[model samples]
Every structure is written in C-alpha cells, then in structure tokens.
Target: MTLDGLPERGSWKGLRAENGKCQFLSWKNDFKPDGRFTITFFRDAQQTQPIQTEHGTWSAANGKNELRTDGVRMPDVYTYKLTDVDTVRYVSLASDPSGDCQEDYDFIERRIRG
Candidate 1:
C-alpha cells in the first residue's frame, strides 16, 4: 500500500529543521483507493510529553483536501491543499472557529521501511 509513492507500512525518520530536533519515528499505516488513510506517528524526541499520536483520514478532491481525525485525547479536523502528488498543505487562521487545536508539528518525513 502506498500513498503518492509513500510506502503504507514503514518508519520515517528525519530531523526538524527549525530546531534540529532528532525526529525519529515509526508508523503502521495504510491508504485506501478511496483516498482515505489511517496513520499512527511515533516521535523519538518529541517535546510534548506523553508524546502525540494522531489517527486521521484524508480525502482529495478537485483542488482541496480535508483531514479528519478522532485522536486519543484530542480530535481535530484540518483542511489543506493537495498541491500535488508529493505534497499536501493545510493552514488554519488563529481566529478560526474550528474546534481544532493549534500545534507545531512542522517536519518532513521520508520513507525508510517497515
């Protein structure tokens, strides 16, 4: 299973450019043909204690994308743009009325292996 060339089941490791934090991680996730996915991200040196884990589903439409997640403690819905097959981008204004919380999870993840 793959999503825009990303392996469905594998671990992606990288460093956060903003802070140079060692972002080691693992994930057991997959994407369906309907453009929906289930993912679990594990960060090695996460600043947020208890770590942050998210489970969400993303759907691609004409030029927009929507991500809805029913997380363990906090659930959120994020809408982003399907820029291309390799990138997905989303943003929310601080004053947005959505129940979603703001987080700084800025990083890039590349395929490693299962």
Candidate 2:
C-alpha cells in the first residue's frame, strides 16, 4: 500500500452472497476527511435502495486501515489493507467462532473527487 492507496475521497464496491441465494449483498463505501465514513449495503447491483447503512470513522491503525462503526450491532473494529491502488482487502476484527463473519472480502474502489 502507498500514499495513493486509499484516496482522500472515493468509493468502493463489493458483493457478498451465500449458498446461491437470491438475496445478495453489495457494499458501497465512501471516504472523506475529518475521519468520516459511510458504508451502505445494497441487495442488488442496481443499487436503487440501501438495505442497511453503517456510519463510522476511519483512520490508520498499526499500518492498516481501521474502521470503528457507531452502533450496538456493528463491529467495533475492522482492519483493512489496500493491496493496490484499486483494490482493498477488509476483515472484521471481531471473532466468529462459527466461521460465519470471519471471511475476507476485497472491494474494487472507484476514485471520485470530493
């Protein structure tokens, strides 16, 4: 990862689905200054409406991108690494002994001016 890895402002998208289910998951992430960040989840590619939204803050933690979401349900900490200028690998720090939420997901981000 380089200084140009996580741009000051941009968007990232990724998809998640289980067991060939019709209901899939899409993540749309927006980055901004002042430690503000927003992650929106859409059920489909059209992205017409968001099924859930998480408001959070992002910053560097131990050379990794750390995100702390606000709310009781959301994970308190998430760690990410920018594999390159256009891709990001994200994983939640919270443990899932059942192997449900422990998988890593890579998001392909689109650079945007903000």
Candidate 3:
C-alpha cells in the first residue's frame, strides 16, 4: 500500500548506527500533517529509556522526492526513497560531524500504527 506522497502523519522508528555501532542508538520520529515533528532518542531498542527529545519542522520538497527538516541537530536535507508502504529510507545530503562513522549509511524508518 505504497502512497504517492510522503507519510505525513505517523510515528516512525529506526535505529541509527553511529560510529559503526547500532545496537544502542534507536529513535522514534513522529510527524504531523501540520509540518511539525518530534524525535525521541532512546538508549535501547525497546525505547524504554529516552535520552533526549528534539522538535523540528519538516516538509516535502523537490516534487516530494526530498525531505527537509529544520531546527534539528543533524543534516537538514535528505533524499527520501520509499521502500514500501510503511518503510522509507532517508539519505543525508551532508556528513554528520557527530555520527563519527566512516561509512555512509541510509536511515531507514518504518511507520508504526498506534
């Protein structure tokens, strides 16, 4: 059930591998149709221990092929590709100085239902 546009309103979860380690860096991103977003970082995969939370504004651009986020700490722009109805991959447009990983990796997020 792939949608023609971005999943504008939903909760998406993905594990971001940092410094080549992924087991400890997990996050959930909630997007709203009103262009607001909230990102919650967790110390564990189960998301029981939240480390930090950030708020930002997001929008689809370049004919819905790109995603741009504002007020977040990381890269602001990404080339988004939908893998499935509930899965999307975001490739950063710039390098993340805080990531410390040598290899570039795509951030894959899956939409979750409440």
Best by lDDT: 3
* Cα lDDT of model 2 by residue, 15-42, tens digit: 6654432346777888767777898888
Clashes of 3: 0
* TM-score, per-candidate, Cα-based: 0.39, 0.63, 0.74
Tell me the tens digit of each residue's lDDT in model 3 across 8-88. 778999987655543447889988777788888898879999998877677776524333345436655567878888888
lDDT accuracy of residue 51 in candidate 1: 38
- Better TM-score candidate (1, 2): 2
The TM-score obtained by model 1 is 0.39
Instruction: Give the whole-model CA lDDT for all candidates, comma-separated.
Output: 0.42, 0.61, 0.70
Q: What is the lDDT of residue 47 in candidate 1?
A: 28
Candidate 2 ranges with C-alpha deviation above 4 Å = 1-5, 17-23, 73-79, 95-114
Q: In model 2, what lDDT does residue 54 have?
A: 76
